[model samples]
Target: MEKLEERFERLERLAEYFIEEMADFKKWVVRFLSEYKREVDRQIREYKEETNKRIEEYRRENNKRWGELANKLGTIVEDIIYPAFRPVIRKYFGCEPEKTFMRLEYINREKGIYEEFDAVAVCQDKAFLLEAKSTPREKHIEEFKEKAKRFLQYFSEFGDKKLILIMASLSFKEDFVKQLSKTNIYAMAYREWEYMDILNFEEVKGA
Candidate 1:
């Protein structure tokens, strides 16, 4: 009986030792998981910050490039296109402008709206409203058409005069020139050696 009692006591001590070891292992696992989770969260936060920084930098650079392009286009239109157009209009059309107006703004006080013209060259019997661009598109041509169609409504004083719509650009698409000619609008562009030349002059005369 004593021997049997001693065996039972040894078994109880072994059971207690196993339970303690299991509890220690559980604590170690919990600690390791907690540290791993914190490290992963830190890395994720850092990655997000870096990504945001790069995106902001990209946006700033893109805006800067667009601004520079706009400024360059404005310079070309003002310095080269406008100056060359005057001589070409005289040479090709044999019309000398009596008055050259720039940025003519008109407001309908009743409607509370306004329209603007880039330039207007007025002769004795004709007036040409000009739209100048670095790269002329169809939309620009359409806008000029709209303005010229409604010219008399705003400038009723010039009701007897023939209104001509003209566009000047550094370069033009052939398709755009064709479309402009179909509408009887004069499309002019810079040719080789950068002389201002009309693309649709014949069409304008024929129409």
Candidate 2:
């Protein structure tokens, strides 16, 4: 009976030791998980901050590029294409060639509206209502018609004794070109420079 009692005492001590060991292990696991969660949160915060910074930088750069491009386009319209059109204005309208006008506003059917146009070339007695299309399509007819009607309404104020609808399109459909021509509109496509008058060029260039 004494030997059996000693064995039971030994078994109880063993179970107590096992319980203490399990408690220590659970504490260690909890500590490790807390550290892991803290690290994950810190990393996520850093990544979001970095991503936002990059986005802001990209927006600034993109805005700058867009501004430069818009300025360049304005320069091309004012310095290059508008000047090249001087001859046509001089020949048809008998006006001095050194003229400049911007197509800023127009009236259609006597109704005023906010508008922007490609350009307006003017000499003393003639005005050219010019619109530039990167690649003109037949779909442009409605807009073109509106432009023409506007010119007809305001030609007298502009001293537009002669009216020319000058358009510069990168390209055009054959049917569109034919239809525009049939409408008695003087039109020129990219490949059709011969359609432009040389006498007008001579007068504009002082040749």
Candidate 3:
């Protein structure tokens, strides 16, 4: 009932319609994929930014805690260690200090001299100069020796008395105590980790 050439023409029209529909479908799929990729990239960028902000805040908090701890340790020399000086001096030196001074500063503008002493104790015939450190090291020992050399220049009244230098800390290594014994300076620290006493008093007295 249908002619062969007419049937062929009808099939060609259907083929053309399918081709146009396929092209539109492909364009829509590409657009959807591109939009999805952009959304994913934006989410990833926001996540990274939030993570970095949290990390920076945590770091700042950690630093604040460490700073507070350091301040507490610094005050130990002034508050805890210096207060124990009187008893230690009386026990070791066999006499109580007549005059006690803490955090004393002496400056002679005319002579261009400036000095600061952590603690000083004066007796009838002896003057004790105390230097306290939270953590004592070899450099601190050397620095205290230098300070002792200039003590009489600042306090001329103490020049007539026998000057005794004391280096004090919360604790000292056994080897460091031995090293201190060889020096003229007396090392004061906790004995048996309980009470404060001079570690090298006898050795220093004999020297």
Backbone steric clashes in candidate 2, count? 0
Model 1 lDDT per residue over 43-136, tens place: 9999999999999999999999999988988777567767776777797779998887777788989999698777787888988788887767
> Which sections of candidate 2 miss by over 4 Å?
83-128, 133-146, 149-163, 169-207
The alpha-carbon root-mean-square deviation between model 1 and the true structure, to one decimal in Å, is 5.8
Range of the 10 consecutive residues with the lowest summed lDDT in candidate 1:
77-86
Candidate 3 has an lDDT of: 0.87
Better of 1 and 3 by TM-score: 3
Question: In candidate 2, what are the lDDT values of residues 42-151, reduced to their tens digit?
Answer: 99999999999999999999999989977776565465556556665565557774456765565465654546666776665566777766556776766786876766
Per-model TM values vs. the true structure: 0.66, 0.54, 0.70
Can you write out model 3's per-residue Cα lDDT over 2-108, one digit (the tens) per residue?
Answer: 99999999999999999999999999899999999999999999999999999999899989988987898777767777788999888888989999998889888
Query: In model 1, which regions exceed 4 Å deviation?
Result: 1-62
lDDT values, one for every candidate? 0.82, 0.64, 0.87
- TM-score of candidate 2 to 2 decimals: 0.54
Residue 24 of model 1: what lDDT? 97
Q: Could you tell me how far off, in angstroms, the CA of residue 95 lies in candidate 2 after the best superposition?
A: 16
Q: Regarding TM-score, does 1 or 2 come out ahead?
A: 1
**Clashing residue pairs, candidate 1?**
none
Give the clashing pairs for model 3: none
Model 2 misses residue 171 by how many Å? Answer: 7.4
Candidate 3 ranges with C-alpha deviation above 4 Å: 1-58
